[model samples]
Target: MHILLVGAGLSGAVIARKLAEAGHRATVIDGRDHIAGNCHTERDPETGVMVHRYGPHIFHTDDEEVWDYVQGFMRFMPYKNRVKTTSQGAVYSLPVNLHTINQFYGRTMRPDEARAFIEEQADTSIEEPQTFEEQALRFVGPDLYEAFFKGYTEKQWGCSPTELPASILKRLPLRFNYDDNYFSHRFQGMPEHGYTEMVSRILDHPGIEVHLQTWFDPAAAGEYDHVFYSGALDGYFGYALGRLGYRTLDFKRFTYDGDYQGCAVMNYGDRQVPYTRITEHKHFSPWETHEKSTCYEEYSRACTPEDEPFYPIRLVDEKALLADYIARAEETEGVTFVGRLGTYRYLDMDRTIREALDTVAAYLSDTAQGRAPRAFYQPPMG
Candidate 1:
């Protein structure tokens, strides 16, 4: 079977490798010049720092299968994401941990004391929270909400926290202890060689052919037995329904001498700050030593046709439009949608790989039983 795998990100690379290993010819194409998509990483020519072109991506997954699978491609160095944030002329730890609570209040409170204090500060009047603002008020109370989340969420999403869903804040933890690690996953690390090289190795299979800087032409779909699309769901159908809402990032890159900020990610939680966060690229790979460092001041805004879409804003209006696109995808033949952009969701690296593997298994099973593959492994509506 000749398979067309669009978008050479993790989704495309994993699926292409699986199909190629099963003796099927897989042609992988990406609009970008690189293979890793948003996870693309390259070394700075001057600074010698491994730069994450599209912000920082720390690989953290609790799934043992997904963790072991990535290890097959590249050596992953032990990395923990300890994020710092600045608010009102002060720097504190992120995720609203005990240390942050103690530092912000200038009091040495233990875990139990901090928990009780936060609960007391919380608004007991609101029984069930619907919006992000209400969720924050209910969980961490007004002070912490304004100091840590309010401004940052506004800048990141380009909207008031009151307008956003409570589910968004629900994912963020309000730690009782002093543990400042951003993620609670067992496996957390970054590729030693960089994400692009890791993905390049994934695509380096005998039966797989890679075509970078190539755009998918709908007319070309007929030439292949099946098409695995990881591109935008609306883009596949030429945005016939309407463009889905997305929040894109704009990066202001700069080079520095020695260390800058002394941390990997420094977030600005104040609305006065124009950019949301600053990432020091060299800090991402602590194993490698370098005198110079490269960093990016990231700003989030509404996505346009010319900009690269980063985060999907699946509000009520966008959901209705997405339903129309999903209907069209179901009616279409020889194409299966996969990955974040395809399904219109914010997915981590592990979730993307796990779904890709599942997609391959389903495809093989369907072909063996003489049945057509489903349009999606996970439904878009969910």
Candidate 2:
């Protein structure tokens, strides 16, 4: 089998490696001159720091198989992500923990009391909360919502909380305890080398051929027996239905004398500020040291055709558009959509790779008994 993989990100790289190991001729291509798509990392010539070009990509996953599978390419260093926030001319621990709750309200409440007090504080009205604002108010009340969530949500999503769905705030936890480890994932760490090096090693097999700065063509892909596309799902159809909505980021970087915030990430939760967060790239790879540091102020806006899409909006309007695209994709042939952009969902790096590997396994299983490859491998939500 000859496998053609579009997009040299984790999904493309991992799936290509798997296909090649199965004695298939796999060809991988990307628009960028690098291997890892959004997780691209390179050495800063000036500071000698490993820079995460897209943003701070902390490799965190609870899946033991994913953790062990990724370790084959490069050594990983154990790193915990401690995030802070700047709001109301003051700093606070992120994920809205106990200290933040107490300081914000000027009350000394223990873990259990805090949990109980927050329940008391939450609005009892609006039995079924639909919007983000109503959901937050119902969960943690107005003061805490305004101080921590309102500005940040507005800035990050470019919409008032009322317009957004309650499901958006559901994953963002409000903890009673002081544990500030951002993710509850069991395995969290960074590659000893940068992501580019790791991915480069992953795709450096004899049977694999990598083509950089290549554009997609369905006619061109016909040369291969099977196609695995990790590009935009809507893009595969040439946006015949319409462009599914997406949010993209523009990064502004600055080189400072020393450590800037003493933390890797800081979210500027103020609608007054145009950008959402500032990431210190040097801090992401704490295993290495540099006298100077580089940080990126991230600004998010509607994704343009020219820019790389970072996040899918996945609002009602976008979902409607995506439905039409999925139908068009099902009618098409020889291509399977896999990964975050392919499925039109916001996915972490680990999740994307895991899905890609699973997709290949599903395809191979179907082939062993002699069945045609499906247009997609992901199960639709009921």
Candidate 3:
């Protein structure tokens, strides 16, 4: 079957590659001039170093399949992400670990001592924590909450932590040990040459044809046997159910000599700082040493129609709209919505590739049995 894949991101590119390998013709179209959408990387002409055009994407995943799948294209150097956060004129390690606790309060404590101390600090009155602030206070106490999360959370979400869900803070683990490794993943690294080359290698198939700088017309799906849409889900439906909420990023780039931040990602966990985090590109590639480095001070805001959407703000109201759009999509024909934008959720590249692989495998399984392909393929969750 002939497949029309919209967007040249990881999900679409992986699916297209899989489809072409199964002897299906796939025509990939992206509105952008280059491929590797959000993870787009290119060599800086002046500095001769690889630059992540969007923002720093540290590839960290525990899934061995996802890890091995990515490595098939390009080499990845082992890079542990140890993020430092600054707040209230003090710098601390991330994940609210033992070192962070001891340094902030100016007292040394063992693992058991730290655990007991935090438990005592926790607000016992708040039995059922709902908001982010309440949750943080209940777990990490008032002083740490005010310094680390309160202002930073408010800045990132553009709202007080009281209005936000507790689940946001729950995602971040509070460690007992002094393990500064941000992620507890088995495989963690960035591409040796950068993300662009890896993605380009993925699409290097005889049956695959990639058309960049082209807007995909869903109305012209009749021209092809099937469509794999990875654009905005609401946009695909012409916003008949109203636009879904999304938070997009604005990056301010600057070049610096030698190391700027000491680490790849540094979170400014203070309201005084306009942006949430600063990314130093040179730190991402630990294997290659460069004199000059690039940094991006990232600012997040409500996504406009014209802005490049980074994360879906799937609030209560937006989730309802997404439900409606998803229902509409199920009723529609000849299209499969995959990946972050298409599904209207914030997905790391690993999960995106994993899901895309699942979609292609399901389609191929149906073909093997001589059955009709399903309308969509993705694991819907609560």
What is the TM-score of each predicted model, taking all chains together?
0.99, 0.97, 0.97
- TM-score-sorted candidate list, best first: 1, 2, 3
Q: Candidate 2 residues 134-248, lDDT tens each?
A: 9999989988888889998887788899999998898887889888989889999999998999999999999899999997887787898888888998888788778888888
- Mind giving the per-residue lDDT tens digits that candidate 3 earns over 156-266? 888889888888888899999999999988899989999989999999999999999999777898899888889998889788879998878899988888888898888
Model 2 clash pairs are none
How well is each residue in 98-141 modelled by candidate 1, as lDDT tens digits?
99999999999999999999999999898999999999999999
Span of 10 residues, lowest total lDDT, candidate 3: 373-382
Candidate 2: stretches off by over 4 Å: 380-382
Error of 2 at 371 (Å): 0.4
Measured by TM-score, how close is model 3 to the native structure? 0.97
Candidate 2 TM-score, true structure as reference? 0.97
- Index of the highest-lDDT prediction: 1
Q: Cα RMSD for candidate 3? A: 1.3
lDDT of 1: 0.94
List candidate 3 stretches off by more than 4 Å. Answer: 379-381
Question: lDDT per model, in order?
Answer: 0.94, 0.87, 0.88
